[model samples]
Target: MRAVVFDQFGAPDVLHVATIDRPEPAADEVLVKVKAVAVNHVDTFIRSGGFRTNLATPHVAGRDLVGTVVAVGEHVQSWQVGDAVWANSLGYDGRMGATAEYVVVPAERAYPLPAGIDPIQLVASVHSAATATIVLQSVMQAQAGQRLLIEGAAGNVGRKLIQLGHQRGLTVVTTSAPRDFERCQALGSTQTVNYAAGFESHFQLADQRFDHIIDTSGKVALATNLGLLKQGGQVTLITAPKTNQFTFPVRQFYTRQQRISGFVISHATQDQLATAAQWLNHAFAAGLLLDDQVSVQPFEAAAACHAQLEQGQDHGQRLVLVPSK
Candidate 1:
């Protein structure tokens, strides 16, 4: 099996396609013949030694994959050979990655691909959809009709949050560039505010306050958004710069019973991943979550793709790699 392997953490150049021994399924796992895998920022982060250091040498770094089951372990009765499946919890936490000719996945973590869904699009949506599902459904436990605000709404995860929030009957407001307002609205955002024009001013003018606020940009200051929350509201942070910091408004935060929490999809438990997979399958089948701007590249181009992503050259396009047979 030719897999993207990195012997030591460094630059994107450290990644290369190498023939490695194919893995066999454990008692609770299945062997998947790789079709397509999505390259994520976290993959580059781990590759560059910015996140998760104690990795085994020659690590593979793909988190989402859409593939066909080639074999199943003895205890795995739910799946069998030829089953089309997608998984998002790979390439992290000591697990072998999906950027290979073949990868092994725990049976419970492999989700059946929705009928008629494209493997490229399905692979692209898994990471973002799973993060959105965990954040909105599991972490926040958002209810229908609640007001929600999403920062950086034009990005992948932010867009997922808007679509899922709208589907669940929430009033979704988003902050993004003025050019993206229409795009966000088309994705189910009820309102879009120009972040450059100042979100605080827009909300103040509209007298808007949300039951929940999520900063997908990681650049939005918590103190600035706290005033935009309704009483007893909650704020969720999913992305941010490593050195970013803000002064806490302790008095107001406590007085209003406002709460702030953070979530990384990498930290999601097996059960949480399963829950996300179910929602993602339904969303894909309904044609509600699709990435129209995906760039399909050869599997061997992993290193160049990583460089493009790190250099901000991807232009918000989801990059999918198809393994060469």
Candidate 2:
């Protein structure tokens, strides 16, 4: 099978196509014929040698995939041959990834595609969106009628969070540029604030304090956003960037009984992954997902993808490795 392989990670050039032996599945695994896969921000971070401390070298580096089951191991009875599957790599250990023509996934990690869902775009949205949903629910314990703010609302996870929050009856507020304002509103965000000016002022305009804040933007220098939190509210930091320190308001509020937490979807239980998947499937089925904003690229253009994402204008999440038209 041909795969975009890398022995030493440093740059886009390091990722190239190579013909390696196809993998057979273990007794509890299935061999998937990869149809399409999406790149997570973590994929770029790992490739640039940023995550070298945790993951070793010489690894296949994709996190999410959509594929069809060609063969299932003898021990795999939950899924049969020819089932359409998507990757839920949360429980899998090490770097067994989905960046190849074929991937061997434990039966537990392959989720069956829901009925009537687009098999191609399903994988593109499900993996990242699911991770975001479960992490928010676990970290924020968000309830309906509470004001929830999502940073980076135009991005993949943030958009899904907005939709999920609205569906659950929460008052969803998100920050995005002018171009994305209409789209964010359509996704169920009750309020759209432009990040270019600053978020703190807008929060005050709304006459509200956030019950939960999920920061998806790596930018953490904004202090006013912290003031938006009321007493007993929580701020969940997916990226606890060193540059973004706890401001005076956060410190004062901490003394007054407030909590701050962090969450990542790198690890998930089978039940969590399955539940998240179901939630995403429902949202997509309801026409609430905005994955079509993405540009689907060819597999061979994998190297160029790095440069495209480096531009970082948030053109939406782009998926690669599906056969080009």
Candidate 3:
């Protein structure tokens, strides 16, 4: 099997396609023949030695995959050799990655792919949708009829957040560029504000206060979002600038009984991943979460895809890599 492997972490150029031995499933695992995998920003971070260290030699760096089950371990009864499955928990925490012709998945982490969905679209959505699920369902514990404000609502996770939040009966408001207003509205945002056009003033003028606020842009100031929250409301921060530091009105935050939480998909447990997978499968089947802008590339182009993401050139498009024959 051929895998995109990086012997050392540095630039995207460090990644190269190499012939590697195929891995077999352990008693609790299953082997999948990779059909398509999505390239993520975190993959670039790991590849550049920024997010994690002490990786395996010749490490593979993909985190989500759509594939077919080719072999199942003795203990795996839920999946057969021909089942179509998808998983998003690989390529981190010392687990083998999905950017190969064949990868091993722990049986509990793989979920059946929704019937009649494009594999590229499904694979493109898994990583972002899982993150959105963890943020909304697990971290914030968002409820219906509450007003939810989403910062940077045009990006992948932001788009998913809008759809999922709306489906959950929340009144979804969004902040993005003017160009994305209609796009965000179609995704389920009831109200859209141009972030560049005096964002705080727009909300303040409307006297809008949200039960929950989530910042996916990583560019919004913490203090700015805190003012938009209602008493006892929660603010979830999933992305941050490189500085990773913020100054906010701590006294006011505590006095109002407001809560702020940070989440990363990598920290999600197997149970949380399973729950997210279930939601994603249902959402995809229902045609609620789909990536219309997807660029398919051969496996060998992994480095170029990583470079594109790091350079901020993806332009809200999902870049997918398929195995090279």
Candidate 4:
């Protein structure tokens, strides 16, 4: 197996590909022949060592991949050879796999790719977007006919939120750069705002408060979003607001009866992934979740992809990576 490995993280240039032995499936695990892998913001954080987690030397950075089952351990029965699957590598205990030609899975973490879905595009959205759906469905308890606001509306999770929210009959509002307003609206965002332009006055004057909010953008403060939420309304914080940006504690969020909670997909149950995957496929089939906008690069260019990611600007929605041919 040829994989991209970095012992130490600093710059994208530090990543280098090397051929290593393919991992064998342990009991209760499945060995997969990798086809496609999706890059998430987590991958970027891991590569740059931006998170508080300390991973010891020699880390293979990637958290999601889609592939075919080449072999299954004796204890595995739900999956058989040749089944197509996508999985979430939640970085538990700094496990190594993905970003390779072949990898092993615990079987439970892998789900089959349904019919009528483009494998690559499905992989592009499913793994990370599951977190977004979980934020709405599991954590925030978004209900039908409610108005749901999604921050980072143009990013991976935001795109899924728009589609999944609409599927659940929730009105979707989103914040993105001005360039994505039309596209965001098309993605079922009933009202769209460009937060970079100036969110305070814009959202404040809208005269309407959201029933549920999914804050994927770290830019929105708990206090700011609390003001945008009606009493008893809920807000799911996917990214925590930076401490330096505020002097006083974001106290109103607790006293105002505004429900503010953070969503972590790693902590989700298997049932949660199954539920999210079903909705993702249904929405994609309905044209609410567009896959045509995603762009894929070869795995050799993982470093380059990280560079584009670090620069904080891109023209597309999802950027997938495939192990070199």
Tell me the whole-model lDDT of each prediction, alpha carbons only: 0.88, 0.74, 0.89, 0.75
CA RMSD of all predictions? 1.5, 2.6, 1.3, 3.0
Q: After superposition, how far is residue 148 of candidate 1 from its true place, in Å?
A: 0.4
In the range 235-319, model 2's lDDT, one tens digit per residue, is 7777766665665454676665777777667656668887777777777777656365555776676767766676674366565
Superposed Cα deviation of residue 201, candidate 4 (Å): 4.8
Higher-scoring candidate on lDDT, 3 or 4:
3
lDDT of 4 by residue, 135-169 (tens): 87789888999999888888777887887887789
Local accuracy of candidate 1 as per-residue lDDT tens digits, 1-325: 7889898889999999998888989999999999999999889998898887455335877878999999999999999899999988887777788899999988888999989998888888888888998999988999999999999899999899999999989999999998999999999998878887356887888788889999887787788789899999999988765677777789999999999889988788999999888888888899988855799998889999999999999998998898862
What residue runs in model 2 are displaced by over 4 Å at the alpha carbon? 53-58, 90-92, 220-222, 240-246, 249-251, 323-325
TM accuracy, model 4: 0.86
Ranking by TM-score: 3, 1, 2, 4
The TM-score obtained by model 1 is: 0.96
Give the Å shift of residue 276 in candidate 2. Answer: 1.3
Each candidate's TM vs. the true structure? 0.96, 0.89, 0.97, 0.86
**Number of backbone-clashing residue pairs for each candidate, in the order shown:** 0, 0, 0, 0
Q: Judging by TM-score, tell me the better candidate of 3 and 4.
A: 3
lDDT of 2: 0.74
- Highest-TM-score candidate: 3
After superposition, candidate 3 runs with Cα above 4 Å error:
53-58
Alpha-carbon RMSD, candidate 4: 3.0
